[model samples]
Target: MCGILAVFGCSDNSQAKRARIVELSRRLRHRGPDWSGLHCHEDCYLAHQRLAIVDPASGDQPLYNQDKTVVVTVNGEIYNHKELRAQLKSHTFRTGSDCEVIAHLYEEHGENFVGMLDGMFSFVLLDTRDKSFIAARDAIGITPLYIGWGLDEMKALSDDCERFTYLLPGHIYSSKQGGLRRWYNPTWYSEQIPSTPYDPLVLRGAFEKAVIKRLMTDVPFGVLLSGGLDSSLVAAVASRHLADAEAACQWGSQLHTFCIGLKGSPDTKAAREVADYLGTRHHEFHFTIQEGIDALEEAPNKEEFHQETCQKIKALHLYDCLRANKSTSAWGVEARVPFLDKEFINIAMSIDPEWKMIRPDLGRIEKWILRNAFDDEKNPYLPKHILYRQKEQFSDGVGYSWIDGLKDHANKQVTDSMLMNASFVYPENTPTTKEAYYYRTIFEKFFPKNAARSTVPGGPSVACSTAKAVEWDASWSKNLDPSGRAALGVHAAAYEETGNTEAANLMNGSPQKRLEMLDENCNSCLIEDIVASASCGWHMFVALWEKLLTTKEGNWLHKQNEIVPYKFVFLFSKTFLKGNIKYL
Candidate 1:
């Protein structure tokens, strides 16, 4: 990743204006510390901070076309730049930077060129001839771009307190229209459900192609292996590609895999197993519990998970690209992710969503299709146990002690009175717990502006479940922490009780009989009740109480007002009657 900042349509042309641009851009220097470049057209200013992943020698930004009419500063890798270059042969060559193609592509195709490129990027292009500019972000927001106006008034652009926004992913903004517009719409976003049948071969092939495309880098590159399914599959595919004759000649050695955790943590042990199996040179980095707590105090946690797979996919800019790039680029290394590859995403999304669910009776775990696709008996990709390991949130994987330490530190720092008055202190998204309060206090110190505060998401997010997923189980809405462990009991009970019964019956009964039993037992009972039973045994009490409250003589409500205990009436109506009626 690189840092990009540009100001267009500003009338100020003084050297002071140039210095101010550089000064503001410097705040993002940590993203790209290798080199810096600036371009000052008649009324536009563009600055770039280069990380030098692709062309180390001459890839400094503010790249231009043959006549210099078109200029661009980009922050990301273009995996298909070679293929794009082949299509635009008429354009004169410049440097070997994967981003240089953006300049020429804009000149030929204008803003429409964004759809032609396949990679993660956020870029700004200026057309000096027309004095028009366009800025765009990638499809899935793999890169970050903030769109804000000058706080100080600009004669050509805006007055004070102009509306500032984060550029929407898969969209573009233009000076000509002065508004944002979508550029990367796909059919899947439609309301109609997809009808494509699942084919394991097509699924596997697409993923392999995706992994292979990301291998197009000149510098040393590696995968971030968490030993979970997604990262493990990425490491497996990358390792196979690295051993190929053409890839071996290009990269010149075996792949290097990396994992970080506290000593004796599950992630550490699992990652070690995966590295040994893949036969790659792996590096395991450990941090003390205190060190992790300190880092959490400084950066806080911003991890997100897929509700369906229960797998953690770190949100793009804040966590993956910016954080991962900064850590690795310090050692002159670039990290590539096969899971985020464009082709891979489309293919994966095209398959029926039902196949992604965890069906424990069939020994199908979360990400079951992916695990089974790579489960080769003749030449296995990974050990059976490693392939079936449960998902763990990255922060928890570091060590449970790390989170416990944060809670302890927060409890000490925040008084009960402060927690009671949390809304008044920071009303926008008031902190509910002491830990949240501590992190928010630190966040406000660095970003005092309202726009900055609004960028961070608020409200409940258990195990990184999407807002819609709260409907999956009623109790999920009550969860305050987003840790994976919070959902462990629910997962274990659902699979263990029902799954074990079905497996046992399979030995003595027909497959059809097993299916019928599973539907009758699992579907009729609400999943929330199943989880509630596992967690508190509350479902048993509720069921027994409901049975006692009912009678064949009259409506349950007629007897509820007189004979039933008040607490029993309330519980019965709420749990059994759907809270529609209340007994006096």
Candidate 2:
């Protein structure tokens, strides 16, 4: 997890361009707050912000191939890196990090690097001597990338969409082919569909393999269990793997899961239930609607579309909070969302839209697909009701009131008179709601220049499908809300019950019946934090003293895994004695 900003094909003042790229990548400080690095040559500049997911002590970006022939900056996990490393054993290798495989693969088959790995990654590899850079985004674009051009610095790379490129994943770049090459193709995606009832076991195996492959990072890792099927399944599989490895070997890796939501949010409850069911160490952050909204407002997305900004804000908070907790390094955890994995997605997306929409035995969106694909009576982690819960838009999952708040904020910012002139002034994506206008106004303020903002593809869809898909439904035009909450007719009964404002949660059952479960886990987690922080503040220091006094169980704080940052904060804080040191 990191940020890379590359300026290639630029003409003059290479140092000047390097400075700009450094500033631009710094904009992603929230993504990779731990370390920063830069690589510069005559025509190319690459700047990286590092989040040490793999090889925390040694691995940092602007990584180079043996002898420094190839250099790259990567921003996502590579799950099959070790396997790829084994395959490319003939090449000299360095670093325990999963991403080191890219440099080696590039050395073996310059542009074939994408064919060898399975993970979500966006990267730019620079060949200084060749005066070129390779760029690519993952197959599903699960990890975001954008390309824009102020002007071409070199002979316009012919047929290249722009001198500034957003590389598509599963493809490699060269100063050679000049662009991306797609490497993923399965039977489902092709024209021949000899549907033999879509073998459930095959789908199941593919998913398990996908999950395993995505587990490649060298750092501590855990699942973000929302207690929903997707998240729970990931957590369950991960926990099972860690347990098996530990029992078989003398030791194994640790998994520490994390979940966050507004106090009393449906997600908080589900995540905790799933965590306990999996029997994994878990960290829960229960925020208020105001906290989530405030985080969104203060987040440094630079993008102005409120929906897009909100997405960036949430991702930013997740990364930052994880850093604060030191969960990644403490537990050697590298996070992956199997639900977002491309191989899994291809199977999930290929079903005829009708079958995909059916509520399996458990009346929920995607439940049938997951149940059928996993061949499970029920996922062990999710409560049967939550596993089969209805369609809740990703945005709404954060908080029901967040969308309403954003809309209200937008409304107050843009007047009816201003909306009337939108078409004349902006013409493209002119503000429909005041919320949108408020976002656009912010966007215009930050990105007063046209090129930077246009890089983010935008238009309209009931949900987040490509803008072209808008033609499939006329309601898309009638509604401006980008959250899935906009699609009430398509969602399950819960959506219908909410009059389409939000999905009705069913951690146990309908909102009316299971209101208790909906608010239970998170409220308890909040109560726990207050108590634990207070206890750790005083008792933990006393424990630290016990450790200095003797080597007994009472001194477990010293013997139990101690990372420098955690211990320093603890001992240092005792010197000041204000707050408790929170740790695993």
Candidate 3:
């Protein structure tokens, strides 16, 4: 994935405005940390932060047609780019990027260029010769595009498309008068009486294809496993997808998967097993609850989490850590989340709630349909026992105590009197909880009195939903808390049943060896060496530890610490020498 930003129809000083595009694009570097490119014409500028995933040799983007007429900076992968290339009987190919097809297609099909492929993408193509531009987002919005326009006299877009525009998923806009028109309309959403019936077989087929399609990348890639069904299935599908791709490509890529959690967090253990079963080069990272607490005030490892769970813990975090400073091999490295893609969700949102509602049918997790939409061979990331597992909202996964901790922390910092008179603090959405008030306070730091504030939907919804879903469930009205902990039985029953304790067994032998490697780990020591040039001890330790523990050996270190006779004995002796060490 990459971050894309653009300023089109620039009647302003186009050359001087180049810096503005770069400045705006800087805000999105968290999304595409590999490299960046900006293409400026007489009237437009397109900027890209690339998370290169395919054809890395020539995949530096703002990838243009042979003559450099149509230029594009894209954010997602086109898995079927090879096919799309074959379909182009005439145009000369440039880079091996799944993104390059856009320039050629724009040259041939104009705005209609959007419908011919399968992939998750948000892109801006600027045509100097053609004197036109086109922008669009992926079908299900798996990728993100925020459209904005501001003329000083009139504002078309706020900061992050929060002002005047919305997420234009699966739609295209042209500078040629016919503004934004959607091209990829799934039969389910576009047809008057959509007959896209729920066939387990069809759904299964589509889901697998969606995952496989999204896996198109030329760089090292991995999964974001939350241990929930959505993340798990995504990880599973991704592991398999990478496996197949690697095998077919000879000596091309190694599918490395990554996951993050707090110390002893539930997701870490669950993710380990999924990684091993799929035979991926798995990496796991651990953070303390205190660290998560600290992250609340920092920009996420990447940006963009609706804070659907809480704060900072997000898709961008894993991506930033893994590829932030790295470039891709010939194959570009892309982080794929099948569950988040638009093509997949289009089917999901269309199905009736009864099909997805947890109960005897599937149990009441929201993405139930997403997990079951796969067959056995297609979905091995989770065992069937875990496959149909109900959702665990993020607030709960961080720890049952996480929400309570956040709320308690918020209460201490943001007094009840403040919430009692929240309307004064926020006339809109009127801060309901102490935690919200805290986030709102921070939000004000970056965005103070924004027109975009209106774009962020308010009013009541227990979890992530439109207000309508909350009205359907009476329990929501009675409870102010939106943590998934409310769905007690679901998480309880899954852990109680499949409770794959094997994942926690990392400490036995291999884990210690892994930790021992930390003593010599190249990635860690290098980071330490770099940090020594600046920063501080905590930064060095945190950075080194991030790389160290993401390895299996890292888990072993955590395990080794448990056996006091070994690592802890040394720790105890060291502490014993320090007079300040307290015996509890």
Candidate 4:
């Protein structure tokens, strides 16, 4: 993954404009820490913060076509680049970058080539000959891209966040046409309900293919195992294929799985079981409630089980995809989500909606189709109980106390009167709870502009469902908790029940082996501060610096701050952290 920023139709091509663009692009340095590149054409600018994953040595950005007329800056992986490169045999090749195919493809096929490319990408291609430019995102919108108008860099890129909105997935913006057009038109996108009979083997094959394609990375990569069906299935498939796959031959066949939670949390325990079963090298990180609170500044539902699924898939770029990209990119780690792969989504969506529905009478649970596909008895992918385990959102799974701790901290910080008056303070998407109010205050402190706040989505949602899907159950409408427990009745264990009978037996068998904790001096805990500081960037560090320095934990964080790369500290310390933060 990389960071891309493009500005076109600017009237000014001055040194000041170029410097400003570089400065703003540096804000995303955390996303792509390896290198930076910039391409300029008169008043237009395209900037890239490169996180080298494919052909790291030679694949630098601002890639150009044979004649150097077509230039492009990209942020994503093109899994089919090798095939695409084969087709462009006549064109003289440049770097071995997977994204290098983009400039050449645009030169060969004009703007219609987006559909031909099979990958998760967001790129801006400049046709220097005519000064016509096109910006496009992958079909599923797995990569993040935003668009804005005018040359006023501040308003175009930052202040007027309302105008600078997300570029629609499966669509492209053309400077010549001066508008947006949908480039992705798959069969499932049509309104007709798919009637194809469910086929488990076909579904399994498609998902496996998706997982394999994403393994095309040069750097060390691991799976984020939440111990849920989605992540677990991904790990199982990747693990099965690793031994013979090309990446494994280089990175090794031992699959590494990672999980983070309070020591005895459900997710931690569940992940341990799966890792042991799969024989993966598992790394589990434990965080205290206090540390989680210190990092506060840094940081669903089905179909009707079909109709809602369609809407949810279309809207993923806004929520799930965005969060996944930002959270992982903060630490210079690129996350590949196979579930969002275009082909896999199409196959999954093509199935009849009826099969997807939660049918207690049929003994099918949520995502039962997926669970059953990997339920191979002869060559078991995972233990049966783990395969059918109940779903838990990260908040609940990452230790139930994690959420409660945040709520408790918020309650102490945000009084009842403050919650009561939240509507006036927030006004747009008014905070409905003290926790919401507390976070909103911190958000506004950093991003005070009205336009910035408007970018956030709000409204009544049940268990992370869309406001429209809240109609699934009447009880859901009563309590707007965005928790899996609120979904009720759907799971083998209902909202009232803490654990399923079959799953409970697995947990009871083992008092999970505890990983060693950090020593009394908290030397290792500095990694947490580095991650938090990296995730939030300099502005957030400045906001928290004074408060952090006043506490015992703050001293530890200060020690961490001292050791982080000089670039981060150099950028903000003298300007803001050295007692001038009041101006901010």
Candidate 5:
């Protein structure tokens, strides 16, 4: 990742404004420490800080087209630059940078070229001939971009200040239109359930391809294994690919995997197991609880902060893209997440959502389908326990004490008076706890403007559940903390005995019992009541079948099958078979 900043249509394109732009852009220098470039036109300014991941020696930013009439500054890797360059054969390129292809493409296709590029990026392209500009971000907002308005039209175009607002992901802002327009809209955004059949091999192939595509970098790269299913799967696929003779010839070594946590943390231990299994060169970094607090206290650059926040809100589909990027990029290492690969995501989402749901009583936990896919006895991808490990939030996995320590520190710093008057101090998102108040206080120090604060997400998040998820359980709305532990009753209750075993047993019985219960209680039954009853009844049906089969009723099965309609019996048989059998 790199840093990009630009201003267009400023009333005063004066030396002072240019200098101020340079100084403001300096705030993002950490994101790109290798090189810096600036492009100042008659009515606009664009600046870039280069991280040097691709074409390190020659791919500096503020790249230009053949005639230098179109200049562009980018803050992301263009994975398909070679293919794009192949399409733009007639255009002459100045630098070997993958990003340089963007300028030529813009020249060739104009504003429509943004969709042709495949990668994570936010860029500002200036049409120096007309003094007009167009700014756009990646389809998923993997690269951060912010736009701010100043006191007036001229000031708005001139100011490169912290007061800027986050540029919406998958959007384009043009000087000609003077507003934002949506440029990226996938069909899945409509919340349509896919009708594709669940094929494990197809799903696996898509994921493998995604991992392969992300391996386009010339520099050394690694996977961030948090010991979670998503990260573990990414590590697994990348390791398998890296083991390929061709890939090994290119990378020249085993894949490197990294994980960070407090010493002896759950993630540290789990990540070690995965790295060892993958035969990766694993690096485990430990930070003290105090050190974690200090890092948060020493707030990083503004661009970094904004990018992290935007990634969480917009890229919820991927879930861990920003975190994985931020963690690895901090050390100048490019991280790839196979799970977020576009092809992998499309295939995974196409599979019926029912396959992803957790059914603990049936020995099917969260991501059970994924675990079962790789649960090969002869060539297992991961240890059974590791494959089936319960999910843990990143903060909680990095030693529970880390979050507890932060809360303690926040409590000590933020007085009761401050929390009580939180609304008045910052009404946009009133702080509900001392921890939030303390953090907001520090955030306000660097970004005092309301727009900056608005960029940050607020409101109660229950166990990573979005606002819509609260509809699944009303009690979820009562929680304020985003930590997984806060969803105590919601998840824990799923395993608890509902204290109505009679009802449960009746529901769990054979088709006859289930029909009787539904007929008896259909008018007043709750979903939980029905689910509990059905689960118990199913187990009971299996036990009764075994008992009856051992008796003189060995022929009872055939008789029952004959009595029940073939189609109805087939549906019931499939349900019971899936619940009773252990596939992996």
Candidate 6:
């Protein structure tokens, strides 16, 4: 979640509007391919694209505060920034950014310091003495902001931004109060119904402090296992508090997790049985469904229940918080969801929506209050048949023959008069199957206008529910099949289980014998990096012959090389092949 673009009152503030805001923040350079920031003030433009999770060397962003008169740029993560830098001990933090305490909490609580931030953000500050400004977004937007009125609305991000919108998720936009406000009002945003109660140790201590405040992070993070049950209770409470994380002193205390699937799937056998019961170092990728439709024609880029999970967590920014923040920031990776933390969704949505429904007359199944709050019977965070494992969905947990190979390759490339003129060729969210009109013709060949097809989210959903919960089942509005094996019979009761048998013969082997065992493990790691770079160039040529025998013409060439005993005849080279010439 690191790609921001801010522009205020610009009537073209020069050097071609800072080279058109560095060419519209290079269309969010795949959500931050490591770095790129821009702050310019004269007409207010605060761009940033940095994905350096927490202090990647001085935390690069638009930040700045001390006598620099407040400025910010942020995208997300501020997990109580070391308790807001111990309440800004008289403010002077120019970076170790958990977003440099939002320009010293807006110069010590100004526009009410965006509700004293916590985690998941979408900033934009700037003050520079009274030239005032603001922008906010987290209480659940989870990170993504978007507001345009110029650059002609921001053609999807900015081809001369003609007009843009999305900036409302616990809002706040000021510029001296000229508009937006709603800065996150909780108490379960009032639609009545919560009665608190259900305290399995206060909902397992607010989901283990929302998965240990998203493990704060200085980098190397993981856990996206679709072993389900909210990513296997976020990888069993981050592999049980990953050795007391400071990102386990530089990515260690062994918790890696991942998953992706389809070769003996059910989310790679329940994420390799919860990464072999939480010892985690898992990985597992596997692909194939025409490599997920050629990685979706090659390019970057779920659920409801319980007040339909608070209207799908307030429409998760707009679909799983914009596909988990632009599909893991397209790959620069930074996904922290801890069930979309925000004070563990206000203490699991202030409980008592009948103990989150699905009763089955008392053996309450669905999330059974988060599997009876980590049902830990003496250090057991999982393994009660994987905490009563049930929901899979992520396209049938990766396999059900991958949505029947994307509906038999979109019914052999969408014909039958293109599904009867798919509402006159996508008359806004049209695609009613043929795998959603072959992924809306690869998203209209990369966003063909109409405000990028009215920002996507179309109708009907089945296993991925909501078209009013697909009218709460009448054969789910006639089977839309969004894939938990189209209405979950628990994917054929965990589709013939199968995990071991050498991981089912290495996931049903032979894709040209796994590309000849990955080209024999890349020629055995390129011959062990060419024999450790020829033993580090023969130990830097014996430390340059012992620093030329400690100089003075190498002490007369080391006393004529110890009285001419130097037959250094190591010269065999017909590209030194057969047993690599070792005459010593």
Top lDDT hit = 4
User: What's the residue-level lDDT of 104 in candidate 4?
Assistant: 88
- Candidate 1 lDDT over 203-246, as tens digits, reads 78877877777776544455666676667777777788776624
Q: Residues 15-123, candidate 2, lDDT per residue (tens digit)? A: 6656666666665554566788888777677777777755768888878888887888887778777678888867776787778888888778877657566776778
Clashing pairs in 1: none
Counting clashing residue pairs in each candidate, in order, gives: 0, 14, 23, 1, 5, 13
* TM-score for each predicted model, relative to the true structure: 0.77, 0.69, 0.71, 0.82, 0.75, 0.31
Shift in Å, residue 477, candidate 5:
3.6
lDDT of 2 at 373: 58
- lDDT (CA) per prediction: 0.58, 0.49, 0.50, 0.66, 0.57, 0.61
Worst 10 residues of 6 by lDDT: 575-584
Report the C-alpha lDDT of model 3 over 19-104, residue by residue, as the tens digit. 67677775555445567887777767777766544665568867898898778888766767788888898989866777888888
RMSD (Cα, Å) of model 3? 12.9
| Angstrom error at residue 490, model 4 | 7.1
2 or 6: which has the higher TM-score? 2
| Global fold similarity of model 2 (TM-score) | 0.69
Summarize candidate 5's per-residue lDDT along 1-584 as a digit string, tens digits. Answer: 76677766779888887887777666556456677788888767788877776666788888999999999998777778889988887988888898899889888887888878777777888888887788887776655566763111111222345556657777888888888888876654444554566677777667667666676654545565667666777777777776553435645557766566656667778899988888977766665544444344322232332232333445442223333333223333344444444555556655655555556667767567667776778977777777877766565665555555556666667889989998998888787988667656655644455655555665555544444444445556676554555555422212222233331332221111111111222211121111211111122222222233344423332342232111000001111110111111
Candidate 2 vs candidate 3, TM-score winner = 3
Ranking by TM-score: 4, 1, 5, 3, 2, 6
Query: Between candidates 2 and 4, which one is better according to lDDT?
Result: 4
Q: Quick one: ranking by lDDT, best first?
A: 4, 6, 1, 5, 3, 2
